[model samples]
Target: MNANFAERLAELPQYLSAHVVLSMCALLAGIVLSIPLGIQAARRPRLAAATLNAASVIQTIPGLALLALMVPLLGGRIGFLPAFIALMLYSVLPILRNTIVGLQGIEPQIREAARGIGLTDRQRLWQIELPLALPVIVAGLRTATVWVVGAATLATPVGATSLGNYIFAGLQTRNWLSVLFGCVFAAGLAIVLDQAIRLLEIATRDRRRGLAIGVGVFLAVLVAASIAPRFVPPGQAGTVAAGESPGAVQNIAGQTVTIGSKAFTEQYILGALMQRRLEEAGARVVRRDNLGSTIAFDALRSGEIDVYIDYTGTIWATVMNRSEPAGRYRMFTEMSAWLWVEHGILTLGRLGFENAYGFAVSREFSEAQGVDSLDDLSAIAGDLTVGGDPEVFARSEWTATRDVYGLGAARTRSMDNTFLYAAAHDGQVDVITAYTTDGRIAAFDLTVLDDPRGVLPPYDAVILVSPQAAQRPGLAAALGPLVGAIDDDAMREANRRVDLDGDTPAGAAAWLDERIAEQ
Candidate 1:
């Protein structure tokens, strides 16, 4: 087996446990909240319309969007809480709808018969209505189980640990094994839970007390086993470092640090590098990878995350909402001052590299069109189609570039960041927004057009620390050495290791660390 696969397997218990716990909690919460409301709605016509309509509206709002919206709604709280809330809300509609339908479908004669027998309305509901509705209600629960389990994979970007970690990291690093591993486990979980619920439904419908008890016991055991690993004492679990005592390194012992990273290969590599450095200092590090650019910044400002890397241009264009050209150093200086004054965040200085967005084209296309710069491309812009990642189309950088270079006349296509290079190479797109540090530029033999108008801002990568984390002893001391450590070539090489050489982010980070030490 591959060493990387082995390492990922070691993390399975943690990931699987979190996934199961989260999905079960969300589904349970949905059942608890929805069944009661569903019962009440069944009794009143107006309430049923209002409640079902509300749930349907929420259902219509895409699952990922609802999850992302929860971050800001909760004042930048990420991880289990936001993810749980969103998934729970998502689970509500199906169960609630089913409950109301099941109860309403019961015959009037049945209710009349119970009323004639001296049973109150409440007694009639529990004894007659609920029993008849068991199968349909169980079906809803089964549907919700699958939905929540699958949707839970998207919780990774919100800083939650789940099987999504495997998928997100795999997509960024192009590791199909990791992606498949996450999918298979998530689907298998859904299947198991679905089957268990089916058994309960059968027992309930058939009035088989023994079978119901057995199914209940099975679920109890499953839940216990899934969450057991979480209760294991620290250090009793396997050491992060093989063959070394947990207390061997104590530079920043007893301190806890959280690192955040955006959803991409470069960010993943940088995150792993930071994680390794903090671990070497003996800090217990927690990583929140696969975050959106804005989500990461918000997390840092709110002190939910201790440290992460951000670019000068991103802060200027998005956070500061500034459009005027400030020289690279001036932008960095002003951005640092603004962050400190407004949000109490500290800028620990640049990492000696820049990964700017550049318009790139295949060598053959560039030579054929005699295009060497944006100025040259603008003349024939209307005849070509440009491609970029989803976020780029909405960014100020794209707006500025479009207006300045007359690219507004060109067609646009949004694709995954990793696919942009291949699209350009295959002639699917005439031009693509390429990251300067991406190794694929060289591999694909593409030409990055010169920005004669200088519309795009400089993107110097810098380290940022939350105000709370900055106050910690030795935090800066431990991380300061990395400020001027990696140059552009080194970063590109690190990215190349992951993108082209099939190295995991951790392995690439280790290779980069060795290179920096030699330097």
Candidate 2:
């Protein structure tokens, strides 16, 4: 609809291609494996019932829950592989069930006729049952394919770039155009695939069967060409060339570094930027991102990740299991010392950003109730509903603070961070757990309550690196200057550009780089 719309639209091809590749891989794998299983189960009634029931149970589990369960087991892994596997698991039930049903639906007389004509059981299945069952099997495939294509879009939350990127970015920034564009593109691609397969189903009927096989081969070749680049040999991922130094750093200790982050806009941008910088300095780089706070912290401790950016307040309250009744500087200083002694984690200095946790209420609600401080809100808390991110419920800052401040909400619901602001602004919820630095708080004209109990923790963004990573040449030197370059005001404005003005993350990162470089 505007220049920004066109710019975002230009990103569609790469996004759509990734989406299609992942969806197809899962679809193919699911079909190839499920068909045989389906056939076997069809011949054996008990096995068929058990297999179909198990698959149906898997189908009943929430997709996001399945993905979350997979991340820890898969080792904070990302890209297309984990998503592909999960989507394939989901695709299995429909294909397998339908194949079994289709095969059984074939007439018994046909089997008898084939047997009487001297055909073996195998020949009967191949020439008679399979041919007749093709259309129903194709229908099952079509259903699975559509489901997979839509689910693959969710892979972006784990750092794989697909159409979900557009949806996430749009939601965070309140840009409906980008969201609409992503939905339209995904739907269009699914329709095209469905039509192509429908054509194959029609052509495979009787005399035109040879043409359908040729068409499938041509499509297979096209898919292979597109996906070949991503399938590099295993060891190639972390290999470094001899004598080629990056930045001022030379050789690292025969190890590739993986820096990880939680799944959020700010976190993703910071993680990607940090990875790029480390790579530029000549060290091999990998990323383990979209990890929860506790998981990422544990990953660093276990050496699954070399480094990650965490908040000083999160460490003080969540990791160190201690709270501070002090200001930002004091909180960070105490948290930094405690981390080294208690967790053996080196807090590499603050990133000059302070993202504090606070409670927010709609402007109208606040004005109507004259609520301004934790004490004032406590009086009216019983009438107000609370909306919070999933982490907020368990995090000491929210739960402990509510108790300490004598605040009580009538009801509380966990929702995505973006939805919290929208729900509050729209008056669906009277209160929300909000970040002090979030751009949406200001954009929505919501007022934050004063924490008189000093219950909330100070959240200063800090880089936490493993003790081994600290020894790398030029690592600290390269990153030290960025400390204190991104204070509250600068961060608020950058976030505003994206959240209120619909600027893309790349555009926001560029602006941040300029600001940091200028200092």
* Candidate 2 TM-score versus the reference: 0.85
Each model's lDDT: 0.89, 0.75
State each candidate's clash count.
Answer: 0, 0
Report how far residue 21 has shifted in candidate 2, in Å: 2.1
Off by over 4 Å in 1: 230-251
Q: On residues 425-453, what C-alpha lDDT tens digit does candidate 1 reach at each position?
A: 99999999999999989988899999987
Which residue pairs show collisions in model 2? none
lDDT of 1 at 107: 94
Per-residue lDDT tens digits of candidate 2, residues 1-519? Answer: 687878787777667667778888889999988999999999999999999999999899877666556666777555566778888988998899889999999889888889999999899888889889888888998889888888877776555657776776676666788788779888886887787788788897755877788778866865775465433112122223223344445545334777777766677566755655555555566655456787677667655567889887788778778754667888778877876776677888888888878889988988999988777867766786888988888887877777886665557889988788878999988889888878888889899988876777778899888766766665665456567778787777777777777776557766886777677
Candidate 2: regions farther than 4 A off: 1-3, 207-210, 228-265, 268-308, 315-346, 406-409, 466-475
- C-alpha RMSD of each candidate structure in angstroms: 3.0, 4.8
